[model samples]
Target chain A: MAQATLDIPANKIWGGGTSPFGASYGKLMMWFFLLSDAFSFSSLLVALGYARHVHADTWPLVENVFFHFPLTHAHLPLLYVGLMTFILIISSVTMVLAVDAGHTNNKKGVIFWLGLTVVGGLVFLGSQAWEWYTFIVGGEGVVKSIIVDGEVQKVLVQGANLQNNEYGHTLFANFFFFITGFHGFHVFSGVVINAIVLYQATQGVFERRGHYEMVEKAGLYWHFVDLVWVFVFTFFYLL
Target chain B: MNHVEDQSLHYSRPHSRTPEESKAVRKKILVVTGLLSLITVVEILIGVYFSKTHVGEGTWTLIKWFYIILTLVKAGYIVLVFMHLGDENKSLRTTVLLPMVLVIYLIFIALFEGEVLIQYVQEFMK
Candidate 1:
């Protein structure tokens, strides 16, 4: 009986010597990594929600706080972040095209689409840097009463920091810096990874390997970055 | 040169497609992108214009719910299509989505606890 069982082919979906989920090891692991990352971001956003609810009365209106745009004196009211969202979404499309081209073994298509994706990521990082700059510099300072040296004094506070902000509550800037800054770091890392993969593609690395799986893996990471940004954009800016 | 072509090692889809198939894939990408863009535009319009106009009203809360739902729709598309989870085996899909339930549970717990804490604080201050 033991010999018979050993001789039988384990051809079931969960059988040995085959992937259970029809995905390669690397891709499945990437998905799990993204899931864990999702947990991290969800925790942050949920905390933000809780804090926003707790401070409902004094919470600053996000639009009123983020009104400025790059090189524009006019108040744009979500236009700049909206542009960022489009850039991210477009880059995500390009990433999917890259993966599709990889599936077809089209080296040129992979390089082109991946190149555009890298450019999109760089542009987004630059845009985020500008936004951080605007936020740190802030607008005309807000005057608030503070106790300095045991006496109440009217002090003008400008910009945002860990301690205080011209915005209504300190937690507002705290969450803003933490969440967006974390997302920006992810974007920066994605760009770096994409640039490296693009360089490898130019060197015909995947072509010689007989498959462009690396590009697809990189594309997975890239699209995940875009996916996280979708939630971040909604929670941080829109809602 | 050696080529790796094992179904177990490679992805689920074949490594090449016909021109028509590739075109269809590209078309799907374009369609999804357009849908995502449209939803974002609608969200911004509501967030910017209607939010300002509806301040402190039931409609504002309703609009927020609308935005959240639309955001979820966009997120689903990105994960399902762009990341190609929709193309994966059913087992893979379940594996990925099942854990997300915990996240939803956490959100509700946090929101509910926050409400209770704020109520207790208000009563204490009074």
Candidate 2:
């Protein structure tokens, strides 16, 4: 029985040698890193969930907080965020195209799609910066109590911080800043990595190696970022 | 000798699918993108509808559940198609997905314990 078991191929027993799962070393490593990152993000979101649960009665409504529209005084609840989500999703589509092109060794196709992806990322980052600024600047006519000549007077309170916010609870802004800021940082680094990979592709580095696995790895990271955003959008905005 | 080595490096054949196969792949990608976009649009519509309407407490809770389910569906589809996890071997898929169970458990416990703490605080105040 032991001899018969030994006769079976190692690949048959353990997927494959060294890789053990048919994935290359780098791809497997990327998956592990993503899994760890996922844990961190999930924990943060869960913490946010706890906060929301505790403050269920007084938690600021997402629609009321994010109501401003671009270049208009009209309140467009979730319109801008919807646009941002669409842009990110479209960028993810372009990234898939780039990876598909890589599979076929189409350098020009990869370059074009990758360029579009980078542009999409930059657009998203710009939109996020504007959003953060808007959040900090806050809305007009929001009032908080102020001590004036030993008398408490109601005055407009703007912006947000750890201690004070125009929103209902300071925890809301805290989580928003922390979670979205962390995600934005990921997008920034992803764009940088994409640019580097694009440069390498142009130089025929992957072609020289007879594979575009680098592009595929980068694509995995991009998709993971988009995946995380889906959850964030649901938890923070939709729910 | 250097020229010979360079030629060898340049001439190695990468995997090349035929035009028909490539077209199929493109179609699959489009389908996945369409599905994801559709789910997102539905989610947005539901959110807008519920916000505009004064639904019962039970109905509101149901809608929130819908949002969470839809989000998970979208996330699952992306991981399966765009990340190519669906095409990967069983062992590889398991390696990537199995650990996620722990995270889910963590979330459940955190929420439960957090609720308990909230109740405790409320009682203490009374």
Candidate 3:
């Protein structure tokens, strides 16, 4: 039998009883890892909230700042963010399906869903890039114009927008790029991990072992990605 | 919930957890999704209302507090139910949640420090 551990009954924790779920060492360690990773993310977001609090009175409207359409003259609020959120939610669903398929030894099902998840992840990253580009390039600003006679001419320099002003001449933008960039890297890495698992599934690797510990581990990671997005959605977009 | 009901069964192909199990899990997912959408709608409403009415500080404060609480609730649900932490051992569960308590403390202190620092800087620039 493949160590089918369940929860440690509630009453037994204080009374020196061995935890039922304690039988699975990998699972317990995964829980610890998730806790630490969650903290690092929370630290970054908390700093963001602190900074936002100090500057809220002058903070540019978030939607207005983030809404410029890529390579177009139109702007719409909550457009890209809604798309990003939808992508993440969809990817989470696909990942759950992959986990389910892995447990069933359904190689084709696992590959299909895992592939879809990778695609979803790539799309989300692309959207984030577009959002970042707009902030960096099309950012709002007014510049002094030099006119000949009746015409006005000037080079527009993005002014004191949130991306340009706060964080010591836009440390906000710097940190935004750095933190979210790091997170996106995690997503990219997760996609690779999923690909490897898909390949293993195709080879019928886990069938011999009779347990899907690999799937459980990957599920922990994929769920963490989804979990991080919830906070990112709240702090970065919703607020 | 019994021995037979919870017994590990080898399954292949489409991966439907027995039909009854499927219904149970689907029900759980749907309920969580419903709560999530409700929270999102509430967020949109609060943002709109604040922009329009310039409501009382008491009301505004309450809304802010509400937003924070709901944010925590949504985060908790995703972790517990979807992440399967709800099925874990007690010690393991605490290991995941206890550090979160410290994060709350850090956020409070950061807010205070940020306010005081901003005030001092403004005075200095004067």
Q: Which candidate is the best by lDDT?
A: 1
TM-score of predicted chain B, candidate 2: 0.83
The DockQ-derived docking category for candidate 2 is: acceptable
In candidate 1, stretches whose alpha carbon ends up further than 4 angstroms from where it belongs are: A1-11, A147-152, B1-9, B12-14
Which 10 residues in a row give candidate 3 chain B its minimum summed lDDT?
Answer: B5-14
Q: Which scores higher on TM-score, 1 or 2? A: 1
Across residues B16-106, which tens digit of lDDT does each residue of candidate 1 receive?
6777987898899999999999999998887778764457778777877888899889989988998888988788899999999999899
What DockQ, on C-alphas, does every prediction get?
0.64, 0.45, 0.31
CA shift at A192, candidate 2, in angstroms?
Answer: 0.6
| Span of ten consecutive residues with least summed lDDT in model 2 chain A | A11-20
Tell me the lDDT of model 1 at A185: 92
lDDT for each residue of candidate 1 in A13-116, tens digit (9 for 90 to 100):
36566777877787788889988998999999999999999998889988888888867799779989999999999998889988888888788998999999
Q: Which candidate is the best by TM-score?
A: 1
- The RMSD of every model to the true structure, in order and in angstroms, is 2.8, 4.0, 7.8
lDDT at A166, model 1 = 93
Location of the lowest summed lDDT over 10 successive residues in candidate 3 chain A = A160-169
Model 2 segments more than 4 A misplaced: A1-10, A15-18, A145-155, B1-13
